[model samples]
Target: MKIIAGVIIVISCSAMLKKDDVVRQAFDHAAKQTLVMLKEVAIKLQAAKAESKNPMPVAPRTLKDGDLVVVPSRDWTSGFFSGVLWYLYEYTGKKEWLDEAKKFTAAMEQEKWNGKTHDMGFKMYCSYGNGYRLTKDATYNDVLVQSAKTLSTRFRPITGVLRSWDHSRDKWSYPVIIDNMMNLELLFFATRSTGDSSFYKIAVSHAKTTMKNHYRADNSSYHVIEYDTLTGKVLKKNTHQGYAHESAWSRGQAWGLYGFTMCYRETKDKAFLEQAEKIAKYIFSHPHMPADLIPYWDYDAPGIPNEPRDVSAAAVIASGLYELSLYSPNAKDYRAKANTIVQNLSKNYASPVGGSKGFILLHSTGSKPANSEVDVPLSYADYYFLEALLRKDKLEKTSYKSIQ
Candidate 1:
């Protein structure tokens, strides 16, 4: 019996080693494909800047037909490509990636004071936030602090949540979308950097308010929750991107999961951690989630097998799970689920190595109901996919308790 037990232990250890090797290989492949695609993107963007009268391209958004669609710095998605470049720099420690990251990140500096929208974090933090983390440049610090202050302007004291849109007034009195949860990280960063507890307080208020209102009985999240600015009353629940008001939007759910996990990380709040875990359960245990762990644009979308898969959602969920694993008692399960997502994305969803205009992953649905950016390779998808890979690598080297 003792001899048999020893043999089983050896086999288990060998299997674990082999699994680690597979993950390492996946990382290597992703790094190679990313470098190849981004080099082409840089060349094309430079040529376009020289010929066009438009503002400088800050990031690649998606593919229109087969061509690259680059956005100016003011675009909400402008920071993701820069964030990707920073991830590449971190992974390869190459000066070329560092240079490209700095150039792209610099273009987003003008948005530090642009309070017209609530995407300050998506527009600035993803770029400059990651830049500061990697390089510690003092200028990046100023950009981030100012960006947080600008984002704070959208917070409605009565509503206890940041207003998500300024242009959709005709549709909602005070619109707050699940995507806004992602912006709270910038606020938390500001509090840490400046020692201004106001940022922290606002972030906590938003998180708590959303937790109370956004979730349904099954822990599924609504895409949009409209509020009455005068009374702090819940007006209505709506869906701008999902199939229906009550249906769970895949990416929105992903945002909620990532956001709460991040909140827990910053605050060590057990309620936030519990909320994140519940969201994770809702995602993985959904009847419509595909075998690959990628989900349809909406969990309740009518066509399940035929609907477009949102790789972007999968990327965000994978990244969030990696962080949640570090904090939750169910660390092993979360890690396994995240690994499955990374493996499937690296294997089945990637763009052709030298193709897709340099975007890394494919088949990301961006607001399908609007018939916009459907079945495309999105920049944010690539950003979170790279982030998930880095987080997975860290988990392999360190224990769960060692991370935080």
Candidate 2:
């Protein structure tokens, strides 16, 4: 009861926000409130780990190998966990948090990632990047190299993009997802870090494939597409995230925004920059976007209570916005919007590190196919929350006020 009261009070602080102001100040205040409850948050992670009798995927989901390692109760935990550690380390220059982050980094190596999953970018690279930056562990470098090798193996020459899904149907390779665009950043990073050009070439080709097919006339993206790998043609563009064939999913749009910005960062391609700006502009100006930083799972989705919001997507975009801000030649407004999302999420949506609750965001959607936790805490939600925090902390430290 007391905890609920505290949460309510903390949430009330969110109301201090106004439209024009960048949200860093409000977010910092909320984070300070969370620090008051940080010990409880750490304890929750331990308790959840110890009291666990039900094995992996918590209780709701079945035992899939991918879900066991490198997952929050939902997918996308690393982006949050590593993001938080990165944020803390950046702020305090502490060694303890850095040490704790090392374990997760090491644990990811055991997972079965041969680049068959779109999430490889979200999982291995995110944690490995943390490991490389934090401890400079030579082992981490080796693990990253292996994961890159595996990820590259998924590159379908016929499709000119990495394949995503391998299940139930003899591992069909035609379907490409919009989320794959975000994953290509790993290739660019791997190439630059390893002085290998193959990685860069693959990343560029993948981006081009997405640009040509996955998007609609309005610059919105489709969640999935069935491609003709042999002929390098798109067979069908379906709506895994949307309501119908052409409806746009807001989170997918956010992925497009963040992903294209990342594409531009790696390739310096003018096309990617323009596409990112288009997506960001649509997302920011759209009437359906909630007053809060979070967005509905689909833009045209009916406002039923069952509809899910993608806080993880928002976090991803915020991090991308920060990068876009840095990379954009004359794009001040995009940076400001990015800064705004970070500030707003930190101020309103993020849950403090209280009572062993590793989740940073309050609302996230996951695996609608399983009728899973609809509007609940998710691993990726937590990941993006942490990522947003890291971006905010870095911006603050650099004295780089967000451009308005």
Candidate 3:
């Protein structure tokens, strides 16, 4: 199934098929390519994680796997390093990466005081999911459970949005960011883990609020929509992820698609399926979409007219599409779309030049604030890329247990 290595042969054979049939075949081919890339990327990343002596990268400073420290004065995602190893485990089913990811699971507690942002998904799931899947270690489970409990405590009944903190001059507020949707998967998992439905209820309620208030009529999504701290009403829908009001941020859209798909997977809700598909179509049909399926930072974005694309967004959407396909009326179309994205990402962005010994995908974005970390490398990009690969691999009936 190392499909990209023989894509030319596939293209030649594909000419005989009908348009719909061709799309299905193309996606199937791409899914295979993604698998090959995941296997290769994870193998190299595992080596980097092992070679790390202190689990922190040295100054002169470039990012590497298992490195405890990452770019300072940057987004929280950069520092959450071991999560990549966990992705490797999930994608490749390799035990060594899981063992490595476990080492960093406990650090999130100590780092919790690093000041929470709208990225609890990065903080909690990277370790919690890895730990649960790897050792079935209840210590990791306990940490995740406690972290989620801590997170759930922040949910505001008034606003129906979780509070995110970034203290400035002794102030913090219920800054509702779209990325919070990704963290809802934790709530669904917590319900199963603890037999408590309260977490699930809160998550669902928040998602409903977000759906009603945040999305534009055109289906483009806003990044931040501030809730009235005192009144629990929608104060404003702003664009923190994009340039102006009502702008469509690509990653935010990706989050909605991925998040809603996860919700549907857990609850079997048709509404979530519809919402996920709506966002997916917006992303797919956007005029700014490049020949390669990955997107520029935002559809109506400026600055770099051809600004670097985010592989993380593409990977997340592809993963969501795979899930969406499972429940679609035209299952083949959804799956083909998912597969094409996986293939494009695998062949174009994935390092066909062969391992850098560290980086997996070529392009990923971080905070747009202060123009810091624009189109730079990212850990979550690597993590979700692995996830898309694994999700596709699982559907193929391949034995993931071999890596373990």
lDDT of each: 0.90, 0.64, 0.65
Task: Report the alpha-carbon TM-score of model 1 versus the true structure.
Answer: 0.94
Task: Summarize candidate 1's per-residue lDDT along 150-211 as a digit string, tens digits.
Answer: 99999978999999888778889788999999999999999999999999999999999999
RMSD after CA superposition, every candidate: 2.3, 8.3, 7.7
lDDT of 3 by residue, 113-230 (tens): 3335555556667656666776687776676666667678778798887765554313224567788888887777788899999988988988888888778887778887777778
TM-score of 3: 0.77
Better of 1 and 2 by TM-score: 1
Q: What is the descending TM-score order?
A: 1, 2, 3
TM for candidate 2 is: 0.79
Ranking by lDDT: 1, 3, 2
TM-score of each: 0.94, 0.79, 0.77
